[model samples]
Target: MNKEYINIALADDDEDDRFFFTEAFEDLKIKNRVSTFKDGIELMEFLEKASLLPDLLFLDLNMPKKSGIECLKEIKASSKFKEMIIAIYSTSSSEEDVENTFVLGANIYIKKPNDFEKLKKVLSEVVTTNWQYETSGLNKENFLLRL
Candidate 1:
């Protein structure tokens, strides 16, 4: 078995969602180094630390301490971490929330699936697609150049 690890960071307040996400990732047979943050504050703290940046981020909009929107703003504002792929993975299907997330520079906004089977499928697709894309290191200057 090729144990190639993919680093993924998740910022969500719901423990059940985190558990399900981890299970789904495992079921996909994806070698992943998954890190979970209870809320945006913890996520921001990890991101601020140079050693903790992951290859991808899954953010939930409604979180305590600091919302995902706030975290997105902070991450995008920083030249050091702006290029990291930040995806808004939330239960919210509100068009306003989706539009705001994209307008604030989120790479994508994904609706959270209710069923475990559906969630697994969604996660598998996301993981596969993310690896297929070539993502450079997080740097605002280079990100803007590419865009």
Candidate 2:
């Protein structure tokens, strides 16, 4: 709710990906607090007990214990996370993945970028956008973050 800082959460299995995500946020001008989770289970545990839920959640599709698709389904099923903006942050940009996540109620679908600067740009755009308005006009066309 506070404009001063944004609460961002990422659930990814890869250690390097998690580090890059946190680093990208650190490089951005936006004030944010990022929490990284090694897997979906850890992410779910934190969300369950957390009083202050994250404003934005980036989920990776593949994980050992639980997958991002599973996490997305669970989060959407619960009314407690209705206000959260879910972003499918994964390396796969397959039509099936995009279609599935869009149908499952995720706000945005972002394919992991190969370059660091591009990642920062993608993150900045996602963070600075007016999600309130963006969600209202959410569609398959705009669902996948192209840049």
Candidate 3:
């Protein structure tokens, strides 16, 4: 919400992925406060109680207890999170998964990169993006973050 720094959140079940995500942001010059949740249930609970919502939410599709798809549906259904940007950060790049999330109102889809350098590059591009302008021109073709 603040112009000085970005408030970023990630809901991912994998410990290594969460660690890498935070580390990537730390390496980047961008000023950001990163929050990580182990499951969608935890993430939704925090969102419900927190006064300040995250500017961007990176959601992993395979989380247990509450899948990212279910969380996306819930978030999209509520007016409270209308302004928040949802990015699907999943390892699965299946066409079905991509199509399903795109149609379900996700702002962008990012296939998880295998290497740390690639992850940093992807995160850097995502963080620096002017989401307000980008969303206005959002289309299925540009939904997925390529390389």
Candidate 4:
């Protein structure tokens, strides 16, 4: 399948998890860029200064600097990034966490897979579906104008 390269940001504290996700992307052979942040505060800071905002964000529920729920609330509250696709990519399977994330305006909630095969499937679905917003021949300038 022909796929456009998309920029993605990931917010998670665990080093091993980060490495695993990076590996999963590599294994999938998806054309994309992935940026990583250890916490919500750092991710927010990057967003504020970043010239190129990510097409998708994968956020974890637990972190040291700021919680994912708090970050989600802030992102949803902001008009600047309101249209950006934010997904809750966490280990939590709690109903409350899922409900709250959606209420806070997350586009999707995905549990972190335990194995490489599951992670590969998750990555494939994410690239093929959730991140595939139709541009419909609109360039960045035109898209921004329409927005």
Best by TM-score: 2
Candidate 3 stretches with Cα past 4 Å from truth are: none
RMSD to the hidden true structure, all candidates: 6.1, 0.8, 1.0, 7.9
Please report, in order, the local distance difference test score of every candidate based on alpha carbons: 0.78, 0.94, 0.94, 0.78
Residue-wise lDDT of candidate 2 within 5-32, one digit each (tens)? 9999999999999999999998988889
- 147, model 1: CA deviation in Å? 26
Report model 3's TM-score to 2 decimal places.
0.97
lDDT of 1 by residue, 1-147 (tens): 124677889999999999998888888887888899999989888888857467779999999999999999999999887557777889876868877876788776678887898888877766776432534333333222110
Ranking by TM-score: 2, 3, 4, 1
- In Å, residue 10's CA in model 3 sits off its true spot by 0.4
lDDT of 2 at 142: 94
Per-model TM-score on C-alpha atoms: 0.83, 0.98, 0.97, 0.84
Reference-based TM-score, model 2: 0.98
Cα-lDDT of candidate 2: 0.94
Model 3, position 94: C-alpha lDDT score: 95
Q: Which stretches of candidate 2 lie over 4 Å from their true place?
A: none
On a 0 to 100 scale, what is the lDDT of residue 27 in model 2?
Answer: 90
lDDT by residue (tens digit), candidate 3, 126-147: 8888888988997999898897
Clashing pairs in 1: none
What are the per-model numbers of colliding residue pairs? Answer: 0, 0, 0, 0
Candidate 4 lDDT over residue span 95-132, tens digit each: 78876776676777788878789887877776676334
